[model samples]
Target: MRGPARASYRPVTQRLEVTFLPGLGEIVADEIVERLAPARPPRPVPGREDALLVDHAGRLERALSLRTAVAVFLVLTFDVPRPKSLTSGEHLPRIADAMATSVRLGAARTFRFEAAGHDSSVFQRLAAELAHATGLVHDDAEGEVVVRFRRTPRNAPQPGATRAPTDQAGWDVLVRLGGRPLSARPWRVADFPGAVNATIAAAIVRLVGTQADDRVANLMCGSGTLLIERLLAGPAATAVGVDIDPDAVRATQENLVAAGCAGRATVTRADVTAAGGSWRDAGPFDLVLADPPWGALHGSHVTNPALHADLLRVAHEVGAPGAHLVVLTHEIKVMERCIREADAHWRVRAELRVFAKGHHPRIYVLEHV
Candidate 1:
């Protein structure tokens, strides 16, 4: 056998933590490892499914460009004395000094603080201490620095009547590596009721693996998140979005304009289910993505079965040979039943459960053959 290839040299790594929606830490880790090629792959923090730590050797800007994490934080671990051993008067200055040093290093003029697993009294004390040390004016509305403090043991019981902290472990102070959360994309200028999160939308687009110059379509495209994400991903030959609701169509159109992709993407007020033979001329799309209504709310859940059936029928009509259809929804049972009963020429290629907002939505990638 040939000699093993040598590993390329990488820069010194820094410990960084990425926060994602719960249940998606592994996906985020995979993304980090694939994109950043960290010296050490990301591993979930103990007892916290929402956070993962990685020793990244690449530029922070590159990590930020990944767009998978909600917020990336630079961790500062400080060992504290015993519980109640040091009150705000004694310990507050030290904590503030550390945070202030972090801010100085970060070079931000303003900051904000949030205390977890603590009541109002503790929250106030910590916030007050940080404010004093950093001398960075606290601007909760739009602070450049997002300083978060948490119990060292991680998810230890909050000091409350029901449960109390027995011992005081040191604390981990996380300073946000960026000014704004990565989930808040600048392209999302318009909003709708069920607009998908930008990060989730990006992830779905990545999973679909659309090709440059490929014809793409988004059925039931609410607010045009998927279409915009596709356009942002690469130069598609044609991007089409259809929504039956006029408001959704208008909103998506406005968003496309805001994203400066009006020429590259088009949104029409037409129902995907009713496209029927009318869209036959739209020329079998190579990739079809949809974020149909999941009916999770009180009024919309009942009509999902019909919606799922109609989606399959429309997908069958529009999908090109070897095309892919990616769907994000929370109604697994209805979608699975519809898939089983569909007369369409498609099979589930991959599936993942992702946490979105307060709901856990499943993304299914179906390949048309």
Candidate 2:
């Protein structure tokens, strides 16, 4: 006689909402699969591709380590007809539990609601209830934990749908785990006028693929974003950044020490476009990263094409045969012209266009031939 099969009991899977820049959802998903290796690879939320729903169990400390994520939230779904129902129903305890988990895992002390129309009385009422239930102060100004409520987008209307005209479901309560957004790099002590986002920089490094013994170089390294991200991504044989601006050089130097990237990289005040600079002969680099000004902020458009041409010459001089050059820029026409002009020396390999807020920046991977 065979014994009856025992039913295996599994705990509830914690759903994490990992948000990033709009165009980077796919990259962020791949990173989660590589780093976290969750039970199932993360899937993008419907109608909100910028955010992914990650199913992870138990503690959430490891999930917060994702460099490409802007913020990680512990999501809880509540079935209430109206927003006001949450203030009276069984949702308070559940929210308190989520808050406890967030505080425990993230070591947070305060909480705040990050929602549109947050100044409305409904949000204020909900905030008051959460403070009472969680025993945590609700500090709107400097709160460490951010709680957000979003409606789950459904294709079809539910049997008892009562809200808006479009199909809608219950509220998804998202409690952010950390004191600050992950995009705010701790090592960024200095700021550049048009500095690229840290998460985008991380994505660039990931897409380029790092090697242990690769020699890395950054031209026009404003605020050292690409250099620091590369050093953090993996072990490099040697890394160096050069900029004509003394302030940029100083900022990079400051960030190098702050980021614990001192032994891995060096920063110098030298013109990358000039053939006579000391940094010109220090190359034969395996990887070259560039984030040049796009005429809008730092450099003007009138001379940008010539400047980009000079940049190509400098990279060609220092790059090893078949070396890869990864470039991020918004000056599309100028870069297109320069790449065409330098066709004999370089060839385009891959290109990815990503959105950062309202700005559209294109990333190009080129091979020095």
Candidate 3:
């Protein structure tokens, strides 16, 4: 049997758009610069929230491998007066050419569009034209080439006034470049109820600034996201995950093995709140990581403070002096109070607010004082 074809971004030197989880622009840019070097750094797109622009001149596979962003789009713009015009102009051929360059779209048997009033006659006509032009079936709901069509912003507008439409500065058509979204991680073999998104996990790992020789501990490690991302991000002297639930422990172990980092990491079925010496057998860690239960899914508001405090106790017990404690959670006040009261043992270093799955969460970075 033969394997699937590999994606070759035949064209170099193109302007790409990036839409990422909010509050992660700088981190995403850093991820890009660090991996795809000499390609200009990702810069925030004006008037667009959670969007960035990158002028890339390298293989497209490198961009598709980016972990921190939600989607990367090959940009196409037209100055036509209305949506219908997109079907008639030189735009049609250009759109087809752009689609041909994308490995997903070129090989797809069908295509689809995401746009305002997609069911309208204009869009229906446009879809028909594109199908004829590209010889791909139009399967509105299940198209492999997911097209996002919107009005390119002409200017910053007043609050109540509607922003300009396609009749203004024309339309922008974006085709996602990756064969699949980056967050749809293939290594996720098991899932937990409160498991973090892979992109968020990648961001959290990047925030810690992984090093080659650091010893790491993941507390309350539900699915071993931090542990897997930690080991994948860079080399670590030792990495272990501890959880109170045997189910969670198993989930972490399964995911670690799927990620192919099991040999370099360990998952323990132990309560983090227990005496540090119990698990401290591995020695003090350079970084302690956690994504504790928030009120919604894994825990309740009434008990989070104590839970947060216990997590702190475990961090103090396991972390070496000046080691870092990175926690990602939505239980802000309770977590803040715990850290504030434990001021003698910790210092707040940074706070990052991010959006995911219709909820806002903050990552707190602290130092073991």
Winning candidate number (TM-score): 2
Q: Write the per-residue lDDT of candidate 1 for residues 180-249, one digit (tens) a residue.
A: 7888877777788878888888788778776886999998888999999888878998888988889889
Model 3 has an lDDT value of 0.83
Q: Candidate 1, clashing residue pairs?
A: none
Off by over 4 Å in 1: 1-12, 82-110, 117-129, 139-144, 153-169, 275-280, 296-299
Better model by TM-score: candidate 1 vs candidate 3: 3
TM-score of every candidate relative to the true structure: 0.81, 0.91, 0.89
What lDDT score goes with residue 239 in model 1?
87
lDDT of each: 0.76, 0.86, 0.83
Lowest lDDT 10-mer window, candidate 1? 80-89
- Superposition error at 364 for model 1 (Å): 1.1
Backbone clash count for every predicted candidate, in the order shown? 0, 0, 0
Clashing pairs in 3: none
The C-alpha stretches of model 2 lying farther than 4 A from their native spots are 1-12, 105-108, 156-166
Q: In model 3, which range of ten residues has the least summed lDDT?
A: 158-167
Worst 10 residues of 2 by lDDT: 156-165
Q: How accurate is candidate 2 locally (lDDT)?
A: 0.86
